[model samples]
Target: MNLNQLKISVRLVGAFIVVAMVGAALGLFAIFNMRTLNDADTDLYERETVGLALVKEANVQRYAAVVGLRDAVLATSAESRAAAIKRIEAGRAKSLELMAQARQKADDAESQAAYAKVDEAWKADQNALDEVLKLLAASEPMQDSPVLQHLRDVVAPPSIKVGMMMTELTQSQERRAQQVSDANTALYENSRNVMLALIVVGVVVGVGLGVVISRSVTRPLAVAVDSAERISKGDLMQPLQAQGKDETAVLLRALESMRGQLVEVVGRIRQGSQSVSLASAEIAQGNQ
Candidate 1:
């Protein structure tokens, strides 16, 4: 049905419902986009941020094991060597556990692969540390033993490789965090633009609807008012124009009916006055 054909109340109510629906849609849009951002934030914090910390902690534990191995080899007494050996084993175990934890936090395939490489490098370095500790436990001479000498030559490279792997893992986590942040930023910007567009469209539609309804209601009232003024001035010959099925149209038709009754009454008054004048002149001429 045509909007102008609708009653004033229905038009107003429909406009309100349309605006409300638009608002509800925009609200849901914002909520959905915000949920996406929240998920990204959670992943960045729980996986990338915390996982990077775990990898660094594991790296630190491995460094401590290296220090413990060095101390055990240089000790002169068996008791000192045994104590250092215990510390080295404890540190290595903690480092491996932390590495496992870090690997578990890996959220994506690339991060998991990076952690896998880190685990391999760590295992190789740990083996070297174990060999050095075993030699020290057996009372091998720290400076002259072949195993200790060989460890001295090869140990530094594996330790360095482990450090590199830790760096790689850290960089990977950082990159992942950056990607999440960048994606969220883009999403927020897009959502903002869409919301702005919706707001603009809503304003335009509301204004247009208001104008349409206002004109529909007022134009008919204006015509009724002008017709009423003409009838009050005794200009009853003009036809009334009542166009719609609204209340205003009913009022205009009622006014037209009243105008027709007034015309009949005035016509009767004019005919009665003419007859009285004719009767009075006929009586006066007969007296003369």
Candidate 2:
């Protein structure tokens, strides 16, 4: 169950695998965040930026139509009036097309409602314009005519209301864009913090694994070296505490066996010397 019981090669490979796993985890986390950020950027560009551009262009066309109507009303010549009427028709058509495109791009209920209000105001304005055109075709005098009064009171108000509604829609898009930008910023900060934390954790885990594996190999080797040195110096009294099924344990067992053999040989040599000394003393006493 001890780490040191495993082969040195296995322990080293296990440590490397652990470090690689940590690195892989960090890599996957980074990839996920990058994908999220890319999605956010795509949404901002496609929905917010493109939609805002469409709405602004539609508003410009609406203003052009209003200007053309004014010019038609104030024209002093028949040619100028016809040209003004042509401009009015072209502007109206273009504005309608642009607004339809903008409406198609409206994804949320609030934006759809705003577009509905704009359409209603545009319809009212168009009706008032039609009435004024009819009065002009009738060759009515504009000095104190009911047509001019109606144009001022009815046509102008709805056109202005349309402009106001468009302005509100534009503001809403701007606010939504700002919200998306702020969300992206917050997301980036959160991702940055999380990545840093992951990096720190990975580093700590790798270092810890390296230290543990290194000690498991080297600590036992140090013990083996010290035991060998003591045996070389004829200090055989100390016991080598070898525990495991590893090569180090085998080496320690061999050393312990060699030490026991050396102790037995030295004891036999001492006994033989004592026996020879006693024999020499007995011979000298017999000769005296």
Candidate 3:
């Protein structure tokens, strides 16, 4: 049926339900986008950022081992040599542990491959260090020695290679994280725009509905009020135009019935007065 045929209560409830539905839909939309953003953030931090940090730590451990080896070669006394050897072993152990952690944290195939290179290079560097240490323990010469030449040619170059590989891995992960951040930022903007558009549409629909329902209710009430005013001024002949099955229609119909009954009662009273007057005249004439 038309809006005017519906009761005011039904019209109001229907409007409210429409607005609630729109609100719920927008809320769910926002929640889904937010969940996506949260997942992206987690992946960026846990998979990429943390992995970068661990690889850097591994490189630092490799540098420490290099320093220990240099000091062991230059040790002047037996006690100093023993202490340097102990420090060198400790640095090697720490380097291995840090590299393992870095490998475990690597996320993608590229990053895993880079870690593998670092691992292979580190193993060769360790083997070279072991050779140098053996010569140091035998009290080999400090300058122009095969151990010094090996350190300069083999161990030093591979140590640099490992550092370079780790640096490249760190840069790659940073770029990936930046890409994720940019994507998430774009998604956020799109979601905000959609939400704003939905809000505007909802407001427009609500206002339009309110105006229609108000006119539907108030127009009939205005007609009923005018009818009642005329009837109060003793003009009860015309019937009320009750258009709908709503409350206002019911009230108007009742008013129309009451006006008809009042008009009939007034006509009966006038007739009775006329009959009494005629009877009085007859009685007076008879008396005369």
Candidate 4:
């Protein structure tokens, strides 16, 4: 290609690079955004799992307290009402705390369900505690079969149900957390693969363009060298029809025209020298 054409090709290459840079930049931004979203999902899953675990722990403690209270009521010793009350209040506080935390999460479906169940369980516990405390405050028979039966009907059943609910919530939380981890891993892998592919493509395209440009630069120089070699072999009888309107083309044309003119001038000078020698010989013959 000529210089102007090569310059145009270079400009086109520059534009291609610019477009590639933009695309790469946009891809990079998308990767960053995906990572950000993945982090958010992961953080939310952790908090939710922690909240469910908290609720499960609180439920177990409360269930244990219920069993202990049942045993206490079955005894003839003084009622441990203060300790029972403390346990119930602590359980309530823990449930509320965990539920609140779970609700405060940004966008987790499973966590919200777990929190709902915990809230219902809290309400049930509150109602059950109220009834149990009232029954005990009336000094119901400590060892009576009827009172033990009544405790069986209310506190025991609710505790068992709440504990089961917490167990289910915990399992659900575990599954959801695992899913989030898997999704994040997949996203990271996909991003890495995509970026690697783009880089490979970029390198291949860049090398190909480099070869084309190098050829463009070298082709004219090669033609000029060949022209010089031909001139050195005394083969400039015909003018060179140079391809491009460049300095090299002008130089070769000038040298080729000079060769033709020099050949004509030498012919003229030889004819004049022969004419002079003939004139001198005629003069000498006339003198003789």
Candidate 5:
């Protein structure tokens, strides 16, 4: 159906509804993307950032354990050796706890595999440390003893392997964190572009609807005004076309009816004047 056939109020309301729908779409799109970005940020913090911190802390503790073990082997007095052993035990315990926590955060298969390798290397290193501790407890060897050579050959290599593995694990966590950060950056860019496009589309649609509604009302009113002007100047022969069911069409119909009534009244007045003139002429002739 033609939009002009609708009431002026209905036409205006329809235009508003169209614009409102576009606005609603933009709002919903923004909400959904914002929710997505929030989720990404939470995951980055919880998984990537926290996990990397855990891995780094574990590596530090592992290094401390290796250092304490070396100090125990090189200690000159019993009390110093005991103190070094205490440090070794404390560092091992803390490192194990942190490694467990880091392992729990490994979500992907590759990360889990890397943690597994680190765990295996750490176990080997712990076993080697325990062997050296046992030797030291039994003999309390001197600094240049065969036990020192044994420590260098057996215990130190395993500790070095563990450090290397820890380094690898730390690198893995850093890479994963970087990947997550990059993905978030890309998602933000994509969301920004999409929102801008939606805004542009909404503006265009709103403007187009406003123009259409305005013209539909204004064009019909212009025609009505012209018809009224002609009627005021006593030029009533021109007919008005009242083609729609709107208020403008009703006004035009009313004006056409008034014009028809005026034409009928004028015709009656002209015939009456002609009849009076004829009667006056006949009376004069008779009198002559």
Candidate 6:
């Protein structure tokens, strides 16, 4: 209740607030960091996995173009025709190599499924190309013949199937990536709102408790001052009761003891006045 006690109480409250704030900050920081990592994973997967899917589709397209061209080639004695054939073959080999690389680096289920489809499509297309290659090796033109006709018939339906499959795969990858991004954003928002609510609650509770503590400390001082005033009026029959073992109790005890001594002095003065009156009466009778 004294100044020193008030200071101690304030310091204790301050220390508690500092510790609580630090802990809250650390907890919020951890939450924020965890959310960031989650978001990053989603972003990274969207980039790497979807990119692989698109790459696989591109390779499939390249394969289809080469097979279609092979079905169109007619062997001729022209130098330009042979050169074109060789160039198309080289491109087909490069496309296959890229498809293999894409399959190796595929990271997600959707991408892996796309890679599988591309491989199956490539093998089916090769069945037709192999026959066409045989015809080309024979140095014959087959563009208007049954060999190209059979392949065009076989490759058409599958080309349609592969196209639909690739489109579906690409679409599915996009949807999953979008879902991840949306979920990550929602989680971040929820966590931020929760942390903000906690800070607000902590501030309100801390301020309310600090006020209560201040009142508790000052109430003792007010009681001590009132008791001192009562003793000053010579009304010392009852002193204030000491409340606790703290400094407030010590102050009340000292004041109570002083009040008792003052009461005794007042009694002694009253008694001495009575004696002086009686002795003066006796001396007046003797003089008469």
Q: Write the per-residue lDDT of candidate 6 for residues 38-151, one digit (tens) a residue.
A: 767775665676566657665666665564454447433345346646655765776676666556655679878877887788788778777776766666553445764554
Tens-place lDDT per residue, model 3, 1-288, is 699998665677578668757776776677677868767786766666766676676666667667667767765457656776886787678768866766776678998888788778877988888898877877753545677667666786677577668667777776787777767767776777677677767766776677677787778888888888998898877788887899988988898889889989989998999999999999999999
Higher-lDDT candidate among 4 and 5? 5
Q: Which ten-residue region of model 2 has the weakest summed lDDT?
A: 140-149
Tens digits of per-residue lDDT, candidate 1, 87-118, equal 68877898889888888888688988887787
Q: Model 1 compared with the native: what TM-score?
A: 0.55
lDDT of each: 0.75, 0.76, 0.75, 0.66, 0.78, 0.70
Best by TM-score: 6
Give residue 287's error in model 5 in angstroms.
11
TM-score list, all predictions? 0.55, 0.54, 0.52, 0.49, 0.55, 0.57
The alpha-carbon deviation from the true structure for residue 247 of candidate 1, after best TM-score superposition, in angstroms, is 14
Runs of candidate 2 exceeding 4 Å displacement: 1-58, 61-141, 241-288
> What's the ranking of the predictions by lDDT, best on top?
5, 2, 1, 3, 6, 4
* Candidate closer to the true structure by TM-score (higher is better), 1 or 4: 1
**Tens-digit per-residue lDDT, 128-191, candidate 4:** 8778777776775455567666666676678768767877777777787778787887978787
Model 6, position 250, has a per-residue lDDT of 83
Residue-by-residue lDDT tens digits, candidate 5, 1-288 = 998798664677567767767786866788677768767786776676878778787867877787888778787578868987998998899988988887787799999999889889988988999999999898663556677667656786787677667767776876687677777767776777777677777767776776677677767787788978997888878888888798877888888898888888877888999999999999999999
lDDT of 5 at 111: 93
Candidate 2, residues 20-117, lDDT tens digits: the string is 67786866778677768867786766676867777786777778777778867766567767887887898889888977877777799999999889
50 Cα displacement, candidate 3 (Å): 2.1
Number of clashes in every candidate structure? Answer: 0, 0, 0, 0, 0, 0
Query: Candidate 5, TM-score vs. the true structure?
Result: 0.55
- The parts of candidate 1 lying over 4 Å away from their true place are 140-288
Could you say which candidate leads in lDDT?
5
Which segments of model 4 are wrong by more than 4 Å?
A: 1-9, 36-40, 43-87, 103-143, 150-162, 193-197, 200-204, 211-288
Model 3: ten consecutive residues of lowest lDDT: 140-149
